[model samples]
Target chain A: MSFINYASREINLKIVYYGPGLCGKTTNLQYIYQRTAPEAKGKMISLATETERTLFFDFLPLSLGEIKGFKTRFHLYTVPGQVFYDASRKLILKGVDGVVFVADSQADRLDANVESLENLRDNLEEYGYQLEKLPYVIQYNKRDLPNVTPVEELSRLLNPGKVPEFSACAPKGEGVFDTLKAVAKLMLISLKKNEK
Target chain B: MLGSQSSLVLFDEEFSNITSILEKLLVEANAKALFLVDKDGQLISSTGETDQMDTTSLASLTAGNIAATGGLAKLLGEKEFSVLFHEGEKDNLHLSLVASRVILVVIFDQRSSLGLVRLRVRKWNEELEKIFNSLEKKAKEKGAGNQSFFAEITDEDIDNLFR
Candidate 1:
């Protein structure tokens, strides 16, 4: 849920980055953290395992350019990508302002991507949110990998709804902010529509 | 808006001092919003406009989120977690445990850099530890002196359990 603090002239929104294991969701965040301006971010907190599996979520707070004189603040979060972490995933999605479904665009990981997508929809439903109506997007990630699947095929299988998709190689920093901008804009749109 | 209830000092000197210090850090960092919540997930105070943020739910859920994640980490035979982060397209949230009693939340924009944030948190957290200890000492004194203050918090505390 986005909080509009008229007293402070600011709005705070929560966004969750989600995907299957090893799909570059964490990498996507690390890259953004590295590239953001010195004044626009806070500590990048990651709850990960010894082997690097996301335990809880990775958090990074950022400020988008202000809109209408109100500083637009975005609180970014990522769910554990492993399948057994479903309960934790649902918990993190609570009151989420937006979602970026980071699909691992690899032949072997197609099932993982689809399963994660389905889980996203189910979790959203449980939270009384319509997947089609929420502020959401898809990023076919790890595009630079040698065995990556075609973007069209990845979108067909994962993003059948076709909500603002991007082809990204998170490690090399390609298309990361583009995806961020698209989702931020969509989240703002959702907030505006909610106002009316 | 809160009335008929005995005023309780949730932050005490520790909470207030930390809050003021945190506010400066957030502003210097150009963060959008920030807050300090206790281990039980009760919101103590907030800097930055949280009218839309719902620090209430965030506090409860964040404590839950931290607890659940800590539990998972233990199950997997790992150590306890002191920090949590979430990165999305346009926003990010950082949850850092302060002196194991309070959790600090920092929300900022993509326009700011993460390296700077990490640097400041590392410094601010140390100061917070000392201040929290000082508040702890104050609480002990409060308990020894008035006693009613402690009793009041006890009543409120037990009242909260039933609630």
Candidate 2:
């Protein structure tokens, strides 16, 4: 949830990165953590397993300068993308302000991507939120890899609503900031609309 | 759903009242710090010595810890876990739920005992609950009014942040 603390002159917003298992959700967060200026970011916390796979979630708090007089803080979180981790995913969605769905672009992972997207819709519904109404975006990740699905096909399947979409190779930081900026912008716009 | 868009308006009066209560707890419990965190991990207020601590991370992690514990509580047929204590080698943490919407976190060193911390927290919980209850009520009643406070913000202001 976004907390507007007038007393503190701060605005805190929560954004979640979600996708299927091994789809580079954590990589997106790690890349942002590395590139963000030290003063602008907090320690990145990853609740992961011995194998480095996200076990629960990954959290990175970032400050994106000030708006008006309030400092804008964004808490970025990633859910465990494995199928069995559905319960953990549901918990992470609580109070989410925006969502970036990082879909695996490899052709073989298409099923996993679709399944995960459907799961996102269901879980969001459980919380009384409609994915269509929320500040949302899609990232076609792993674009650098061979055998990746065509962007047209990916969009046809995943970007039906045609929300802001980006082709990202997270490990190398390509489109990382673009994706972040897009969602952050959309989230702020949504906040303004919500206010009205 | 209690979505993030719910405007949490903390007036100066409410902030001062919460701060005083926290200061009192810090003094009576002989603790290092006391933090009021929303269930979503936003730090509402804090008192005591915390210049060296990363309260942002602390608030997020504490809320995550409490959420995990609350999930466990549900599995065990409990509505929620009211309090949790973790003792470390030199420091300890006490987490409790206030009004089921916010969390009260107390950190201490060997200077204070768990018994004393718990005792002080119990005495202060009722007051904090009343404060938060009214805060929530005011937010609901003044929802549109609060929006007007930020109505002055324009798209240009938001875009300026990205620049």
Candidate 3:
């Protein structure tokens, strides 16, 4: 949910990064956290298990400068990508303003990507949010790997809505900001339309 | 998710009232700080000595903790846990649900006992509930008017953000 506090002159939006396990969701967040200026970001918190897999989520609060006198803040969160963590994933999607589907582009993970996308749809439906109506984007991540699927094939399979999609190698930070910017822009535009 | 999209629209008047109520809770509970967070982890209002604490991360973690507890409660045939407490060597945290949508988190130190914090929180909960109930009602009644405030914002206003 996008909380617009006119009293505080602040506009806060929640964006979630969701994908299958080891799909570079955490890597995307780490890269953004590292690149963001000190004044523009807050402490990144990750609740992970002993093996460093995201157990609950990873949270990063960012300031995207100001828009029309309102301080625009984006709270970025990444869900535990492991399939058994469906309960945790549903909880994190409660008040999401937008979602960045970080689809693993490795040729072998096609089925996992499709399953995760279906899961996203089911979860959003539970919250009364339609993927078609919500601000959504897709990132075909792990593009640097040799066993990657072609962008065209990935788009045909995962980008059914044809939302703003990006090719990213998150560990190297490629397309990280591009993906963020695209989703953030879509979210703001959606917020504006909702006001009417 | 609540019935409608759970976005908090805080006007100055309501915000002031909420802060005053929070201030009263801080004094009555003898706590170091108090934070009002949405169930979805947005920090709505904060009071007291929070200079050293990172309330943003705290809010998100606290919400996640509460959500996990709520899930456990369901498995045990309960509606919700409603309250959670974490006691540390020096600082302790008391978290309670308010109006089913917002959470009240109190961080206190050795100076305050659990009994006092609980007592104060019990008394204040009713008052906070009443306040939020009315706020929700007002939001629904004047939702169109409230939304009008944002109607003036243009695409350029949002697009220029990247620049």
Ranking by DockQ: 3, 2, 1
lDDT of 2 at A145: 95
Best by DockQ: 3
Poorest stretch of ten by lDDT in candidate 3 chain B: B1-10
Candidate 2 achieves a global lDDT of 0.90
The candidate that wins on TM-score is 3
Model 1 lDDT at residue A84: 90
DockQ of 2: 0.63
Model 2's CAPRI class is medium
**Which tens-of-lDDT digit does each residue in A1-196 have in candidate 3?**
7777767999999999999999999999999999999999999999999999999899999998887788999999999999999999988888999999999999999999999999999999998999989999999999999998999999999987889999999999999999999999999888878877
Give the alpha carbon lDDT tens digit for every residue of B50-155 in model 1: 8787565576557666767666776788766888888877878888888776678888787666776777777788897787667656544553443332223322
Candidate 3: tens digits of C-alpha lDDT, residues B1-163: 4558857777787788889999999999999999999888988899999999898998898889898998889889998999899999999999999988889999999889999999999999988888778887877777798566577777787778777
Query: Which residue pairs collide in model 2, if any?
Result: A1-A95, A1-B4
Model 1 stretches astray by more than 4 angstroms: B1-44, B47-163
Docking class of 3: medium
- Alpha-carbon deviation at B81 in model 3, angstroms: 0.7
